[model samples]
Target chain A: MARNSSLVFEGRQTQLKPLFPEDVTQEYVSWLKDPGVNEFLEARFKKHTLATQRAYVRGFDQKTKFLWGIFDKKTKKHIGVITLYDIHPMHKYANYGYLIGNKKYWGTGAAQEAIALVFDFAFLKLRIRSISTGAYAPNVASVFNYKKMGLSYQGTFKERLLYKGAFVDQVWYGITRDEWLSRRKKLAF
Target chain B: MSTEERIKSIMADSLEVDRTLIKDNASIYTIAQWDSLQHLRLVMALQEEFGMRFGDREIPDLVSFAAIQEAITKKMKSHGKE
Candidate 1:
């Protein structure tokens, strides 16, 4: 496929395409199993295998839950995954989640760009009203990315997640379509 | 200010540490406040102060004060600012 034609959503540094069962690879399974990579993700709690990943890829409904693989535009390397799930059409809302499986891409703006592309798709194309997400308090990177993208802190579930033999808070964040639109405008200017 | 000093100053301000504590070799692993989030903030500050943008490829390598300074210098030179 042509470079630009293949991308469902293209950002400056990252391109996102719908994930398929064929896209599942041993690397993807390894990312799920890597303790350091999944330190803050719920997936870390479970053992992942190629069969499970293939099944997970086939499980998305496409409407209520959409998954996309993030790729580096320059390298054309699949580095991560992003999903918009738990969609409520009547309420025009959904939940967002993402993981940068490639350690090399961490701390780069790939996560932020991939997220911005997803927000554009959610609010503009799907007409989603609000998008919600959360992160473990100790996962400072996730929390900071959400906040930087203009998601407002909703609340915290105190001692909701157990990590390293102790409890940690889960911080919730939400952004309405209006808020995202305005934020996009500000960023453009 | 020199590029090194300016880089240290931005790192100090972004991470909320004393400028003196921001050594050339200081990095996220070495500085308590220079966590992942603060690292992004520091990157943004450097971009704004130096009037240059860093490609995503450059971000991961820009972990330490010296690395940031070197990157900025190279970018500035490429832009013919140096």
Candidate 2:
């Protein structure tokens, strides 16, 4: 449980380090408040201020929930965040989520590198066997990113979420350690 | 057919578009059919067609027709296919 203290995940373009509550900044809170940014996130429902964002950041004890700031290596700027939560010891699986908070970082491969780093960390470092995540069906970009990441389509939860107007399905994705290991090099994470 | 022709064929087949639409400036961002999902399929197609693999980092950059052509060229050159 004392592991990953000062942990840093080094990727080609992105560098990830554990985020403390104090690391939560005003800009970070604004990312949550931006409707364009949190369009598919449940956070859109909430009023996000510095206090709320810091409290959320403080909740990641790293025993169960882990959080890291995704920094751009070249600029050393915190571009977004990635998290692995709800770790189950016996089951050896965890749920994953990420956001490229800085819109300028979008489509710059920052998101992909951030995802690959966390997945590698969970599978290889944490010794987790499987990692899973879900996306709104209308979020075609997210669904497809998971595909390129080598995660298998697990299933669909029908009408699982309300989008702009009507209900939409939620698509689940998952990958096991062996599956990731086999593909990582060729995929070059 | 030549390697470039074959590459275009795979792109056309995978993206369900005419081979001619894959022009010099044709790009994943510009093409309606070349979404993220199709991009993966297109990458797979290129890999199968060229018998080469792209690094995970390279995959995202291989968006444009010219970029993909360049990647394949470099890979082919490394393998002496060029």
Candidate 3:
């Protein structure tokens, strides 16, 4: 909340606002607890309650990480979260993870719009050299969106993650500041 | 059958819709059954039927029937299958 000098990363259909502790509502906690919504999220491993999430929101290191709530423009309802974390100032890089808790927004270009804002901030404002992220191999829709964001497939860590009952490979993707800049210039956006 | 017709049939089968319904302009926005997850299945179905692979990055552009046909055509031309 403190680091958002602009206070918002506005997109066409969604906006990214600081996800402070007070923003942790019952519905938000429910999304974390929902198995379907959390299947690909690392947070799925831990049982989420209102207290734990609120605490997690409060204790985040704003200097090194940012947690933003992705809200639907029409309802102003929080649909999901996008996080930029593990920022290394000297290296000028960071990693990202996101979730679209509301299934209605899936494949509707909402996530692509919201994540573009993350790139707009991290690469343009922070001057981050590169941003990298990993996705569950089974999550084709998410991986597809990552690719649409111009994050090229970097590599795969075989059986590096656990799913419902067994192991699954995790695929990595990344994009540099220069690459992102060029892609955005060409894209309709 | 032409590759385009084959693709239309595959799309119809994977989504459990009549082939006539999937017009050239039809897309995820128009098809109720072509949800995000179902779209993944459609990709797999098309790949399996065509015996070609699509890059993850190439997926987002294949939202409409025409786009899918164009991609498959481009892929076929690249492989000298057309």
Candidate 4:
């Protein structure tokens, strides 16, 4: 089995399972297209149709990137999406991203659980040296979440991305496997 | 000084927030520095000061200043800190 294949990650107070084919739906795609939802998509993925969402979800696997659908165990509801993208086995690292689409779950530590699980996968299973991520400068929540995950701020790239109609900077953050190992118990999901 | 006083001092310094803002019943998420990373740092700081270690259960329960105080008190008692 691949790392995190059993889809049984214990989050802070919830659980994270692999995103199955069934999780893909027009409803989710509609949310993906909502301006409020895609505000941080960086223009390229801002306007995803159901078909595009389907393709994106279908492509996630051991071959491409790992995607997981976050869930609230107590409420038993889907809370968000998280993925380890740009997985490079040779370099032993990947890019991480997640969004708690259900605003109701925002500020509830559900995202924290999702993030902790991602780190667990990256450091324990993949044996990656480091995981990298960037938050669009305007996405304060994203930046806050990454910082909470113990990622160190690298720098900001001005006009790094074009979203909607204007260019925006992206703030980079990264954490190494050694850091994860040193702080694993404290950051445990 | 009381353990609570020491912890509040630590919070005031590390979180860079007003000590008055911290309440015994406040949620851990209320503080800007009570984040995940800072939570770890807090645990390390507390461990160094109090000469104690925290388990996973203690971590989840240590979500607030009061919670940390409670956990530390419990540990201190069990270890004969008095």
The candidate scoring highest on lDDT is: 2
Report i-RMS for every model: 11.4, 10.2, 6.4, 11.7
Estimate every model's Cα lDDT from 0 to 1.
0.81, 0.82, 0.81, 0.72
Worst 10 residues of 3 chain A by lDDT: A1-10
Q: What is the lDDT of residue B76 in candidate 2?
A: 88
Q: Residue-wise lDDT of candidate 2 within A81-152, one digit each (tens)?
A: 999998998999999999988998876677777888888888888899999999887776677677667787
Candidate 3 C-alpha error for residue A94, in Å: 0.8
Cα deviation at B74, candidate 3, in Å, is 13
Chain A TM value for model 2: 0.95
Off by over 4 Å in 3: A1-5, B8-38, B44-82
TM-score of each: 0.71, 0.71, 0.77, 0.66
Error of 4 at B24 (Å): 15
TM-score of chain A of each: 0.93, 0.95, 0.93, 0.86
* Candidate 3 colliding pairs: none
Tens-digit lDDT string for candidate 3 (A3-35): 565748777789888889988999989888888
Per-residue lDDT, model 2, residue A153, is 80
True contacts kept of 4: 0.03
Candidate 1 docking DockQ: 0.07
* lDDT by residue (tens digit), candidate 1, B1-82: 8877788888889989998888867864456445465667887898999998876435645767777878888889899999
Where does the lowest 10-residue lDDT sum fall in candidate 3 chain B?
A: B28-37
Give the clashing pairs for model 4: none
**Best DockQ goes to which candidate?**
3
